[model samples]
Target chain A: MTQTLDIERELCGHAAVGEAAVTVDGDRVVAFVVPAGGGLSLRELRAELGTEPDEFVVLTALPLAEDGQPDWAELSRSRKDLTRRRMPYTAPRTDTERYLAALWEDLIGVEDIGADDDFFTLGGHSLLAVRIRMRLQRDHGVTVAPEALFENSVLSEQAAVVDRTREA
Target chain B: MSQRTKWLLRDPSPEAEARLFCLPYSGVGASVFRRWPSHIGPLEVCPLQLPGRENRIGQPAYGDFPAFAADAADALADHLDRPYAVFGHCMGSILAHALVTELRSRDVRQPERLFVSSSRVPHWPPDRRYRMPAPGAVGVYHPSMTEEQLADEVSRVSRTVGGTDLHPDLLPLALRVLRSDLEMCFGYAPALAPTGCPISTIGWSDDADVPPAEMGVWQECGPVTHHVLPGDKLTFLEAPAELQEVVEKDFRG
Candidate 1:
């Protein structure tokens, strides 16, 4: 069996779970789960799996794609719901933070990036980071090392890097 | 007629050290490599023409990747006379891996190298994950996309990659092909079966669909050499000199 199927089967085998589909969201393994009539919990699901799942989103029913399979892509996208952010969504307040957030919008394809959002966690990658650097120099006239994006990718953190580098 | 003539849109070069079989991405034909030279250094470019697109417009498309791979491996059986490499972009990258795996099972000649460009690793089925809600933002096409949405994707990609919107007459057929191709991609979720052949994962600098950084997952598949060059997803279409240089160096060493 395929790895994806094996994971899905294991998810179904859980006594507390009704229906579930698994997908990779960037670096995380997210399971979109529909509970059995008895119900289930993220804590229980994680405990059952042994290793902690990155996320377990509870749903009433599994959504199927046109192919009649669980729509994993849509499920993956659903996990990125802003309402459920790990940290509260704080709008970009500083000048550099706002500028970085706008670039994040175009490159990551997400809008209204929060100052607290981690770039990699929010699906930002190397190319996007490089683009961020290029635009930072081009638009804001600040030069940040490539490692800055890797080490400090959050909007506020990155903005600070820009501020420090420009002053230097 | 030999599958050689039927599968390869152009004739193979007898003098080359190896053949580089080029696979097209979704909704198009072998013509995606139209601008590519006949050969890059010693490697001859043999672009494969699948059914239901381009020259084979009336034929039916393959239902899935496995069947396509099986048939392709068989069709190109005669051409496996020499060491060859496989290259694919986006959907073609998945197809490229499938074909390489199929060749291994058949115990036919194996590819010296497999170039998978602009795609996620095959272990998990490819999914369309839009990081945000932005206009003309396509995470990757899926079954549920509306006609209007698909049109926008087609326009945006064509404009971005090919530098012009698809012609009005070609839009309908392109959309049809695009939808079918997207379905095939979402359906495939293969195991991380590493090929005996070395893999070179190619990530485009400006490719928004599959970022260069994300291409690192391919290391799990096998011995892989990753390169993130300057260009977008379709930049390979234009056959950049830097890309050719990489293929030449890889083939030579």
Candidate 2:
């Protein structure tokens, strides 16, 4: 059996769990779970799996299509909820910060971005990250690694990286 | 042909000297290119729609890029009577590359050029977490996600494209299609060998995900020319005038 199926089966084998799915969100492994009855807690699920999931979400029932397969569209709704609890906001101050913030707003489709805002929290993914890296090189003639963005998702920190690279 | 089997040929031109077939990034459908003009000079814009999304929602999603390419190449056989090129953005670039190779393998005509925007060459291992299986490896890994996450992505992406919030009722179908598309992407393992056609890559200046340098690795496939376009990845959806100008000049030349 495929590893994904194996994980699902093992998850369903746990008490109080009727169905489970393991999916990746960026670098994290998120498991969507349905309980047999009442409400199942993440603590209980974690104890049963013996391994902590990066993100654990409980669903009344796994969304199923008319064909009876798991509904991925419904499952992906968890990303919305996750974004709400991300790190606090910080406003961009530097010129470089302003430029990136505008771009971020465009790419992320988020209206307002504080300097403390997390890129991933704003719906920034690898593809969008690549776009930002390339834009910096073109517009500023500065080179920075993609990892830099991941490490310094905050606007202030990211501006520091660009400022440092610009000076070098 | 069944209604379910139809491809999205935004503007079909049988007489056009060159055809440009576009593939959507993972988790998206052809509608992503809805704003793209019908023509880039003489080249016709053909946005090929994969199954399990948009109008193709009734069909089963292909398991991997190779399978998707194989089927796409076959279905597009008649259209290939003329000189054509395949364009894919992000993970869609891999699909375009695999489709070109699949066409060559079946003795079908190869594309005149392959345009890959915002993606690395197939040889490059993907993100560490969803790394591609080693060469000669049989399968790719698919990441499991919850429906809420998928809904958030769809809603987020939609807002960028001038779309309103995705209703809760639509989340199930949307996420299902996204998961299937990601499965095809994560499971894809195209042959590492080079193609006869030249390659052109477009990188967004501010993109941090797949930097222009990473896109440079595509040179290994064949002659590669990289162009830096303004804006982020989502800019491609707008099909900005600058992007159109570059593609027009490149394809026409």
Q: Top model by TM-score, which number?
A: 1
Per-residue lDDT over B87-180 for candidate 2, one digit per residue giving the tens place of the 0 to 100 score: 9988788888888878878777778888998777776554432433233221122355455555665776656564456544455655676777
Report per-candidate TM-score of chain A alone. Answer: 0.54, 0.49
Query: Which segments of model 1 are wrong by more than 4 Å?
Result: A1-168, B1-4, B128-140, B161-163
Cα-lDDT of candidate 2: 0.68
Q: Write the per-residue lDDT of candidate 2 for residues A41-142, one digit (tens) a residue.
A: 455456667555576655545766679887665576444433442345566788998888877765554534677665643445444655678889899998
The regions of model 2 sitting more than 4 angstroms off are A1-168, B1-5, B128-146
**TM-score, per-candidate, Cα-based:** 0.57, 0.55
- Model 2 deviation from the true structure expressed as Cα RMSD, one decimal place: 23.0
Docking class of 2: incorrect
lDDT of 2 at A45: 56
DockQ of each: 0.01, 0.01
Give residue A49's error in model 1 in angstroms.
78
